[model samples]
Target: MTAAAVACTGLAYAFGDTRAVDGLDLTVAEGEVFGLLGPNGAGKTTAIRCITTLLPVPSGMVAVFGQDAAGDRMAVRRLLGYVPQQLSADQNLTGRENVALFARVFDVPRRERAERVAQALGAVDLTDAADRLAGTYSGGMVRRLELAQALVSAPRLLILDEPTIGLDPIARTSVWEHITAVREATGMTVLVTTHYMDEADQYCDRVALMHRGRIRALGTPTELRKGLGTRRGAAPTDPLPSLEDVFRDVAGSGLDDSSGDFRDVRSTRRTAQRVG
Candidate 1:
């Protein structure tokens, strides 16, 4: 049997007195698109950080592609690509330059860097704009540029954190299309975090709903929706429950308007109050 692309057993992380990720266990199979769905402050990012080796994980806790993430950080990093929540591309540099930098950072062979950079940009449909400065690109294009940067190293596993945040519906769909296309072309494992339930239903092969630093539910989108049967007195003949409904049932209410970025607590609170 093939080894899982990612595995976490009894993984935990704390920030000061607050436990951000508490005793989490998860497995992402190779060549699958998996999503960690949660509201703000649910520790999805924290868990992702640990998996990507951005934070120290306890011994025997986390592994990437069968290599211990905590013990074999360099090896794991070699096989992994991460597109963080915040913007990463340097505005002053052209898109090609940004990706070329990542190619160097990932230690792509000196002779192959240019070809790798070109392939990465082409994969994300950014070849035409490769010569343009990233600051001039639209939000959607910026996200795609970041995707290209992540792809420059030819990683086996890709990790995305709220990758389409703050984009319009169309732009969000476009970004995901490129991601799905890349995954299909390379057969890479994708682990993404998002509060957008619709995106999870549309793209993920399996999803884990996290809440309060733990997984509240886990299953395919269809299975999760099936677990919620006519909660609001809707007849069986009515439309099936959506992933959003499943989230509300599993994680309770108040998740509808929540952002996935837990770091922006104050801004989220203000937005919630304004909406309320």
Candidate 2:
């Protein structure tokens, strides 16, 4: 059988005295769009950082396509493409130049580099804006450019963190459309974290709601909503709970304390303002 695209067992991490992640276990199947949903301070980013080998796995195991993340960092990195919540595109770089940079960083052969860069740009429908400086692009276009950067590597597993934090509805829709189209074409597995319940409900094949460094609920959008309704003894004729309702059920109204620290808030707001 083909190995799972991503697997984590007994995963744990912390900052100083704070526990960011606690004995986590998760597995994502190949070619599915998986969402890691959580409010701030839920440890979603920390978990993704560990899986992408950006942070040392202080404890537990993380694997990508069956390879151990701790023991084989380079091998794992080769299989993954990541877009952090923070903006990664350089405002000074032309869209084409930005993509080319990633192609080189991912070590695409010199002979194939130009073509790969072009393809990645085209994939996000940025071909016309390819030569324009990224600073001039609109918020949506900038996000798409970042997606192109991640795709230049041709990774099997794509990880995105809060990909559309600060955008108009139209721009948000455009980003998800491109992501869905790319995934359909390449069969790449996508793992994303987002506070946007609507995005998760519409785009993710399955979602895991996390709180306090642990998974509180996991299932398809339909399943989770229906399950919540059932558990609460809602009448069969009652309206089903929305994903947001489920999120609130898990995280509660008391998010300020559990939400990530000041740095996280600052970074997220900065990204939003820039992208907005």
| Candidate number of the best TM-score | 2
Residue 28 of model 1 has an lDDT of: 96
Task: Spell out the clash pairs found in candidate 2.
Answer: 41-260
Each candidate's number of clashing pairs is 0, 1
Clashes of 1: 0
Clashing pairs for model 1 are none
lDDT of all predictions: 0.87, 0.93
Q: Tens-digit lDDT track for model 2 on 162-202?
A: 99999999999999999999999999999999888999999
* Residue 172 error, candidate 2, Å: 0.3
| Candidate 1 Cα outliers beyond 4 Å, as residue runs | 230-236, 254-276
Give lDDT: candidate 2, residue 223.
99
